[model samples]
Target: TEMFESDNVDLKKQMQTYNGLDHPFSIGDELLVENSQFLLKMKTDMPNVVVFTFNDTSSWKSDMNIYKAHSGFTLEAQNLPNDINLLGKDAPSILQKDQAFYSRTTYQIIEKLL
Candidate 1:
């Protein structure tokens, strides 16, 4: 399986920053979601979604290459329950250059909240 959360320090830092700015964002309450451009892992203990702002994540390129590779990808988020060890793979993520966002392309967030 393709793994997005590699226990990398930089990615961890980005996740921390995403949980900043005096705000709380959750899809269904207390669900911590570690996400890439096309993959997401959700946990109940942590309530956050790591947003990836790239058309493609270099990290999962190899994992994805294993498959035939279709035209588009899915916004996948598998639930990793309490104390459950898991990591992996999204939804439409909006990002503004003003804020700290992990991105590879040149794009801007039109509206602050969507």
Candidate 2:
């Protein structure tokens, strides 16, 4: 049971009685616990709530962190290898950018987990 303060808003205030966090939760809707780090995995259940699984890289405990319902950030789903290529020459650069974004975000997750 942890609560974090962000933008003067109390994240997890609604989480006190909900025990749904144990299993996979929603994506994009979760607050990043003020100062925590989480490695993004993939998306599940589009539109309603694009949930993404995350790895708690900073933790020695080897636990998975699922960030559900994150609506504020401009997080685009990573294009799968099998997906159609729409970017033409920009594909390589876009993938590289995504990699960098995930890497940096994972680092931030590590800081929060510690």
Candidate 3:
């Protein structure tokens, strides 16, 4: 199980807040903030893994509270697309790969003034 990792500097120590219904934001919400860092990881299945940190992105325009917005991150596992051929065809099933073998990537989220 190959592994990959990345980090954001300015976002190391910050806070984030989100609001909405029980479901909140969807998979691709395009989060925004002043200066924040995110850490994304790609496990056995590249598409199935997502890791990110949100800092200082909440507002009173909606519901929720400070506790919910104060420092939050997520490590989500999803399903990879069927068309993606990561292993050159000869590779074994994703389940067969060792748990330690994983890949990751990191990025940052910035608020764009529209």
Candidate 4:
């Protein structure tokens, strides 16, 4: 996929700058998604599929992995409760370089607009 390869190439350089915290995401990590508490449990084999448990109860699946250059991994919920705004938004095409992070390899979250 050209989109995949292009993002991977672009993010590789960006990820090299950060050393403190891993960027994009980490498994079992809790994040303030749309100003709400959410846990990124795990990544699945399905394309962009991930187990994102919201509030530790209701689990929602969506494309949430930063494979090469995809970012802003969104949930599959139609309308998130509590006025959470996970959908109806666009991930920035290129995240600020300072936001880049490295895991086993360098990567960035490509804006995934819905």
Candidate 5:
């Protein structure tokens, strides 16, 4: 697993057993060994861990309610369309700014099956 530090330093540390990384990290940073099972517990709220797999994890799992409790929000590939009408002379400029914000919110979700 690799950690992108707040101070712009990238630390790559791979763990084999339970005596690995203890501190909170980002982006599914865990043991990279194959056929290994590990339990992850989020001790603090400051760290943001993002795990994005190409597979649809919810479909194969029979009970998703248990997994839902672990994650904050499991969002699928979707487009949140918002239509805002500005009834003023500054409509054009505001629309431009709004488009930029909308674009920022959007992210391309790559699915393995798709």
Candidate 6:
């Protein structure tokens, strides 16, 4: 997550500098932010999971955009909760170089009749 935050800050700073020079920001170098907290909570037993992330745009406020990305899966009931604190500690180390850890698990889903 630190990697994402640092990248976001750097991108915003670059955009600010560009704006100051009367230049337009390009989408090619845009940063994609993720909801690390919500992502870390998804379990394998759940039918689906939704993660929400916010963008860093203090540098430029004319445009505030929110994007939603989704994925579908079925849980097998053997998944467990992850230790988010430990993951946060490792964020710095992971961000130093351009890399990320991808984990997977199954969640139990309950059906509700309306």
State the lDDT of candidate 1 residue by residue for 1-114, as single tens digits.
Answer: 122344666545544554212222345532332334332334333334333333333457465464332223332222322213333222223334686743222222232232
Return the TM-score for each candidate structure.
0.18, 0.20, 0.24, 0.14, 0.16, 0.16
Please report how far candidate 4 places residue 97 from its true position, in Å: 41
Enumerate clash totals for all models, in the order shown: 3, 17, 12, 5, 0, 7
C-alpha RMSD for every candidate: 16.9, 13.1, 14.6, 19.7, 15.0, 16.4
True lDDT of residue 113, candidate 5: 38
**Tens-digit lDDT string for candidate 4 (63-112):** 67323323333433211231224432343222366887332312233333
Candidate lDDT scores, in order, read: 0.35, 0.32, 0.37, 0.31, 0.29, 0.33
The RMSD (Cα, Å) of candidate 4 is: 19.7
**Which candidate number has the best lDDT?**
3
For model 3, the local distance difference test gives: 0.37
Q: How do the residues 9-107 of candidate 3 rate in per-residue lDDT, one tens digit apiece?
A: 322221112121111222442333233343332233334434444433554455555454325555444433342375555443345446665544344
User: TM-score: which is higher, 2 or 6?
Assistant: 2
Query: In angstroms, how far off is 77's CA in candidate 3?
Result: 0.5
Between 3 and 5, whose lDDT is larger? 3
Count: clashes, candidate 1: 3
Q: Candidate 2 residues 44-102, lDDT tens each?
A: 32222222222132343444643433212333323332223655666432445446533
Residue 53, candidate 4: C-alpha displacement in angstroms: 20
Candidate 6 CA-lDDT value:
0.33
- TM-score-best of 1 and 2: 2
Q: Which is better, 1 or 4, measured by lDDT?
A: 1
Write the residue-wise lDDT of candidate 6 on 13-49 in tens digits.
Answer: 6435432112122222122322523332224322223
